[model samples]
Target: MAKSFTKMLRAPDSPVKLSKIPSDAHPGVDSKADALRKLPKFAGRLADLQERLFAQAHGGTKPARQNLLLVLQGMDTSGKGGTVKHVAGVMDPGGLRINSFKAPTKEELAHDFLWRIRKALPAPGMVGVFDRSHYEDVLIVRVRDLVPRDRWELRYGLINEFEQELADQGTTVVKCFLHISRDTQKKRLLARLDDPTKLWKYNTNDVAERKLWPAYQEAYESVLNLTSTETAPWYVIPADRKWYRNYAITRLLVETLERIDPQWPPADYDIETEKKRVLAS
Candidate 1:
């Protein structure tokens, strides 16, 4: 079921576009260990691409702008943080703004879900990450019935429209769902229990939430059905196989950034004159 949902999300529209294997298709992948091997290479490539993006921004001076936003969603224990750490660690921090989304604070809940998200949008020549995002309104809020069915149902159009606006404005947005099996989550949860220092990360609330796995699955299906768009689609990362998941997501990011073909801004004709003028000082 997760496999089907993930496939629907990542399938390319044209044969010419680079293709990537959805992680959910792989039942086993040790993403952490594999990430150690692939991170240097992929991270290096991302850094190189980011340098071009940075040049684009700096060259703009007082002119154009561009940026990207990556939203990651997953069940508890999914490797969202790990993937972000390894996959995006190479990018320039000068323009990067990674926002880790969690349960809304009282002040945040007073407004719409997207209100908080809007505050974190990436500036030109940077990337932003939503650890968990507005999608939670469609997933958790629906699974837990925190809101009426109609209220949550309306969010699909809202999300689609929101993403459309971002895309129209030149923000390359990608949404990834880290797919983990119930058994895998159980194992990780147990390991979290036995480990001493990791104890602080354990939460009975997360365990209690595990009981509603089936509900979350259904909520995800609905969320995908409504929100998957050409501009911003959800890519499923297989969480069971950590290596494969890391590789798949890293590749997907590279593939997407490559699509943008972020180019360095052309050198202006006034550079010589500007340099001489500055040199006089």
Candidate 2:
């Protein structure tokens, strides 16, 4: 039987509903060390793919622009930062870009939701990662009752159209939601509260919001349902284990960049020759 992550977890709204895989599917959970021992293989595969992406830097066109975009969305403590850091670490500086979005300022909230997001697009020949992306439109807005349910719900179509545009324009958009069990998340949050060094990461308010876990879960389920597509599929990662989460994200990114196959533009030999002749004259 093929391994299935979905069989184990509850279904999300995404068309490709992944129920949690049975415990028998991966007894690896019983041994964190053993499960972790498998990470190097996954990382190695990702590294190999990154090597190709690095080598192919400008293999595609004259201008050699690589417009790859990765959007990562997850609940707090889902290891979004860790995944992105490890994924981009293997690529050339020129091969990648990263944008981290925070709570919107009054100015940001004033404009259309995507107004701020569009301005952050990476230049040609770079893999741009959005730590938390426009999906927040569907996530936070719906959860906080900031917008009417119907209004926030409708943004899903707009998002699909927007991502489809990127796909048509040669940008490979890979989105992901780091899926951590609620119990696991609670434990992690509590750890943050207890650890002196990590205390600052813990916001008392976060616990308050966390108490409304059902609302957040519903919001995520809705976002996943409407947004997952062939052109821009959302990878639902198991993130209770940070190492596994990072490895999974790294693999997903490597696969997307490989598919894009960006290449550097070749120099115009005739123009160079003419310029050289003019210089000699």
Best by TM-score: 1
What are the runs in model 2 whose C-alpha is more than 4 Å off?
Answer: 1-61, 264-267, 270-281
Summing lDDT over every window of 10 consecutive residues in candidate 1, give the lowest-scoring window. 14-23
Candidate 1, residues 117-178: lDDT per residue as tens digits? 89989887787887888999988888888889889888899999999999888798888878
Per-structure clash totals for the candidates? 7, 19
Q: Root-mean-square deviation of each candidate, in angstroms?
A: 5.5, 4.9
- Against the reference, the lDDT scores of all candidates come to 0.75, 0.69
Q: Residue-wise lDDT of candidate 2 within 28-111, one digit each (tens)?
A: 244557546755665676556554554455443445444778788888887787777776665666556788998888999999
Superposition TM-score, candidate 2 onto the true structure: 0.79
Report residue 224 deviation for candidate 1 (angstroms). Answer: 1.8
